[model samples]
Target: MKEQIRCAVLGLGRLGYWHAENLATRVKGATLVYVADPFEKQAEKVARELNIGKSTKNPNEVFEDPTIDAVIIATPTSTHAEMIQLAAKHKKHIFVEKPLTHDLQEAVQVIQTIKENNIFCQVGFMRRFDSAYMEAHNRIQAGDIGTPLYFKGVSRDPGSPPAEFIKNSGGIFLDMSIHDYDISRYLLGSEVTSISAHGNILFHSFMEPYHDVDQAIAYLTFDSGAAADIEASRNAFYGYDIRGEVIGSEGSIQIGSLRHHDIQILTKSGSTHDIVPAFPERFKNAYLNEIEHYIDCLRNNEKPSVDEMDGKIALEIALSAKKSFETGRKVLLSNPTLSLD
Candidate 1:
């Protein structure tokens, strides 16, 4: 096992910057050696702020560097497949954000390439590492929840992203609901067999040109006969709210809270509490834990908990949901790994 895993970060955007910060400061056994972004200034700024030795506008520099053992890919969804394949080709382990690729064919190809390379690839499904969700998962596995039956998830973003981002976000299901789909599968211990979805433009006119909706809902059926309903929105005026509930034959487990802290103030007028403002605030620990897990896997020469197959299946589920919404019907996934042909 390597004494320390040298790491590089690609795409220093919102999530990318956060990941770079974690690697530089919080995650042990990880050394943030390189940072890259198309915007020269952004990359240089991040590099300077994080005290990284190297920063570049081109991603090739990171992959070409033999000293770097791994990379955290926080690039856009459309670019995920190419970046992952490139990293794999360089024999660098990868930690990429969710929905492996926007296209199923590309996702299939990416999976094959990763397998051929035989490098560790971890998908960013941070919810699985969250303390609350992990507790629920452990209890459910221990039979505390008996036989899982139903899953309900709610994910509401306070506001929509810019038009440029929405145009390439792969719509709401892939962009937002993919996490819920993955977590539903994780907690219910089942593969998504079919999905029915619905969505509307709602408040964001900018999304219409992109055919993306500001809000959506998906109903999913699992191979274990478990069911799930997930709701996603980009117009949560109050705050960034995320919650999940798993109901079982014996009992139920609820996860998440709107408040950032446990304490709430009570008054004669009403009760008030600080609401989670965004994803970073809501899943801070989860983000840190996921990166640490990736580093640990590298040092121990072990495969990541969330691998290429999980990423592929989650993308498939999201694509199915999008199809259902477009066709106004339920889409069945007869073969989880159905061929592109």
Candidate 2:
């Protein structure tokens, strides 16, 4: 029998922890070999619980360890490009979370490095791995949604991140709306040609200085003549919600909501509680399915369904939207550039 691939996880935050725990306990043909975090206690705790081979505060330990075959980066968005470059230099396959990099130049460099190294690199656009979304994609490709015309994607969170996080989040367009950007591109099957956006800082007063718009809407014109509308909100008040619809020449398909029952009517003192909470719940299966696909891709030596180009294009759309929101004018995506802080 072949030996297990050695894997390590960087960053021990919420999403990082989840990736570490899941890869350690659930994935087959992979051994959880190391856990790295700047916080020593968090790394040690997770490593102890999972019986991982090593835990360290310095990420260099994991990067330098030749025995470690792959690394999962759940670090902050600002650190993605550097980590990717480092891991590529070490010839380690990498799994990085979304919005590949805060800057397009860095993104381009990382892609070039990964290609030069001839190492597998997968960005976390987990939604593409979703069964429902994949089903929709297959149908669209199979001509079920003949010649797509328009796509709409909505993503709303229950609340905003802490003020400190908001400052560094690259505003809502890069942090949250990027998901919708990716989905829109996936459904449209074409490159975005131009983008226009409008946004407001309605919910959080603290976000004003950072220009962190909490509510945003963007329009994307695709190269194939299809268009898409993406809506995003950091505060939903009630629940997390994400849904999409693809309208084509022949017909349309909509992804169902989270609720088991589509229709519910209640009459009690003229009050009703009908809508289900947002996407974290609605796309639970998608999260698991995405990770499983990553594992399978690694095991089979297959390229990821969502590659660096997909991540770059999504980031391009998101940055364009931000530019449009700021300038109150349409932004062309032909020559995409971003300012990294």
Error of 2 at 29 (Å): 1.7
After superposition, the stretches of candidate 2 with alpha carbons farther than 4 Å from their true spots are 1-3, 258-280, 335-341
TM-scores of all predicted structures: 0.98, 0.92
Model 2: per-residue Cα lDDT over 225-315, one tens digit each: 9999989998788777778899999999896564534666667666444555655556666666666666677777777788777788788
What Cα-based lDDT does every candidate model obtain?
Answer: 0.93, 0.83
- Candidate 2, pairs of clashing residues: 240-278, 240-279, 241-278
Residue-level lDDT of model 1, residues 1-341, one tens digit each, is 77899999999999999999999999888999999999999999999999999999999998999999999999998899999999999999999998788998898888888889999999999999999999999999999989999999999999999999888899989999999999999999888889999999889987887888999999999989999999999999899999999999999999999998888899999999999999998898999999999999999999999888888889899999999999999999976844443
lDDT of model 1, residue 52:
95
Q: Against the hidden true structure, what lDDT does model 2 obtain?
A: 0.83
For model 2, state the Cα shift of residue 176 in Å.
Answer: 0.7
